[model samples]
Target: MFRRRASVVLLALLLAGPVIASPPAIDPAARNPPPTIALSHFDRFELQPVTLAPGLETHKGNVVARQYLDVDVGERVPRLIEPRNATPVQGEPRTLLIQPEVADIRFITGGKRVLFGGFAGSSWALVKLRLVDKATGEVVAEPQFLQHANSIAAGYSLGAADKLMLARLADMVASYLKTNFDAPVGSAVAAAAPPMD
Candidate 1:
């Protein structure tokens, strides 16, 4: 009887063993780079507002005829990848070129001056930028971002509007960068016994 009970106890212990073990956790955002590509975290930067040009006052009454703006999409990807055993990178000095198409303009803010009746014509411009993978000497991704039908407000221009635009656009570009640059994080471990949903 004693021997039989001991044997059953051992069997029960074996059957219950795996139920108590836990699976490993993984971060959803980590990506493992391909062998040829070295992945790195994104660098941070500050937004320095450009001082309104003196010519802007002269530009008003002329009307914002058109604007050509270029936002490169792929420039943001490297920041999403968290490279293993690598030091954080510093934000590079850079500029965002904004060429505007203006029409029906009455004023230009920032110069503390105004133009009442200058040349009134419509203008627009499109821009292209290249973002390179320095190590591979290749362009990883380049997406063109655009905003059409922009209404130029030369009179009492809201500085806040520009700030808001920058913040929103930067966020949009950043998300695109993260999606393209990083790989989906994988689970490093397997559950001893996966539970059925």
Candidate 2:
């Protein structure tokens, strides 16, 4: 009888061991976090044409005007990415280019200037940008939308406002990539985890 009871107790302990000793359920968000692409992994940066805006025709006769906007925005990307260990190469590895599409844009020309019709009031520009892997043509991350506006009260000329708008667009792209794609390891995982009860 003593032997039988001991055997029964041993069997019960064995069955309960796994149940009691099991680890706490891990947060699923922590287990499967968003993907991050290191900037160092990419070889270079490319800025594509501004697609989806109505006034690109304004650049029809002026090569300089088009180039000015493109160069200004293009140059800003490398300066922003390099500090984070990414180099902007003209060729090599795989170029990660930003494809910008204009979502919305408005130019509030108030009145003609005293001499010529200078832009009077304000201008608005909204752009959406996404990262594409030049090699695979795959969009590696979510699209980012950003907007900027300049008012006459702020004393910004139309040209200056346009430049400012381009700057803001570059800023948005750089800021988003830095925060999402270049986040420190484990930081994203920790961020996804739920609070402890």
Candidate 3:
């Protein structure tokens, strides 16, 4: 009986050896987090010409609205991004491209706006934008923005509210870029520090 018990214990120990020697399973992502991108990673930003959706070109006033958005956003984004040139330099690694497209648009003319006001209907514009890395051809981010012009008071003065909506859309895009463009603390410090030489 004593010999049989000793053999059973030895067999159990041998069976458990592999389990004890092997490392526990751990997620690789937990050990090393994925990389995150910040606006500081880019040295230049390019805003592409704003475009209208395929079917929207036939709609009345949409072409003009597209032009307005193109100018408005084009002006505002550069002020916030600090780079106006769309041309990529040779061997440039840190350039970002911003593409804005008008997905949908509803335009209420001034005459209709004055006569019907909010009863006629509200004017609205939907814009879809993407931020892409010029070097790697990777899309960094894609976001959509919507702006509306609704005026309950019907009058000549408020007829141009639709135009104001375009301006508001531009503001929204600028604000979004500004909020996300924060440089990492380390990078900011390094940039501020003078040359060691």
Candidate 4:
């Protein structure tokens, strides 16, 4: 009776060994490619329809304006995709969020022009931006405060001009990522494979 029981137990252990001894499963995030940036709008600032013109030459100095710039992913995504060599698998890439804060915009218009309306000068815009991982809530890129300046024309809307300059900045960022960010966005160190006994 004892010998029969031992044999049965031995058979059961042999059958269960394969199931019990498998290594732990890998995290789902590891298999995927880098996170793609999600479509995002400006949070702290608002884009108004009103256009900005060369107002009266202020006594203080350059005219200062405050507004948020909007990023249209539908329009800009193709531009971002252009520089990247790898075609990431669809539906597998994680999502990242782009946030921008407009600190201040300074317009430098001095003297007076004849044909173009006035002797308009360059406009310098200060902006703060960040990129964050949606799933992990990690800040992928360091907080950046950028000052982008462009020559102001006669009929250019403030919002439209701001959008164009910001879009160029975004393109530069995408190019940087294409060249520098080669590895997975935020992959953890892989665990060693379970040793075969």
User: Residue 3 lDDT in model 1?
Assistant: 95
lDDT of 2 at 140: 63
State in Å the error of residue 28, model 2.
Answer: 30
> Who wins the TM-score comparison?
3
| lDDT (CA) per prediction | 0.28, 0.47, 0.62, 0.36
Q: Which has the higher lDDT value, candidate number 3 or candidate number 4?
A: 3
TM-score of every candidate = 0.31, 0.49, 0.64, 0.37
lDDT of 4 by residue, 95-165 (tens): 55545444344433222212222223344443334456656777655332233344444214433443444
How well does candidate 3 score on lDDT at residue 154? 24
Candidates 2 and 3 compared by lDDT, better number: 3
Tell me the TM-score of model 3: 0.64
lDDT of 2 by residue, 71-126 (tens): 65566555655554353456556767777665444433222212122223334444
**Candidate 1, which segments miss by more than 4 Å at Cα?**
1-129, 148-157, 183-197
**lDDT score, candidate 3, position 160:** 70
In terms of lDDT, model 1 sits at 0.28
Model 3 per-residue lDDT tens digits across residues 114-186: 5445544556677767778988889776656665566453234455778877777777666556656773211
Ranked candidates (TM-score, high to low): 3, 2, 4, 1
Worst 10 residues of 3 by lDDT: 184-193
**lDDT digits (tens) for residues 1-197 of candidate 1:** 99986775565434322222121233434332321221223233222221223443344322221120112222322243223214453565222221212211222122221221111111112111233444434543333322211223322343223222333333344443334334422211111111111
After TM-score superposition, the amount by which residue 86's alpha carbon in candidate 1 deviates from its true location, in angstroms, is 4.2
Could you give the candidate ranking by lDDT, starting with the highest?
3, 2, 4, 1
Candidate 1 vs 2: which has more TM-score: 2
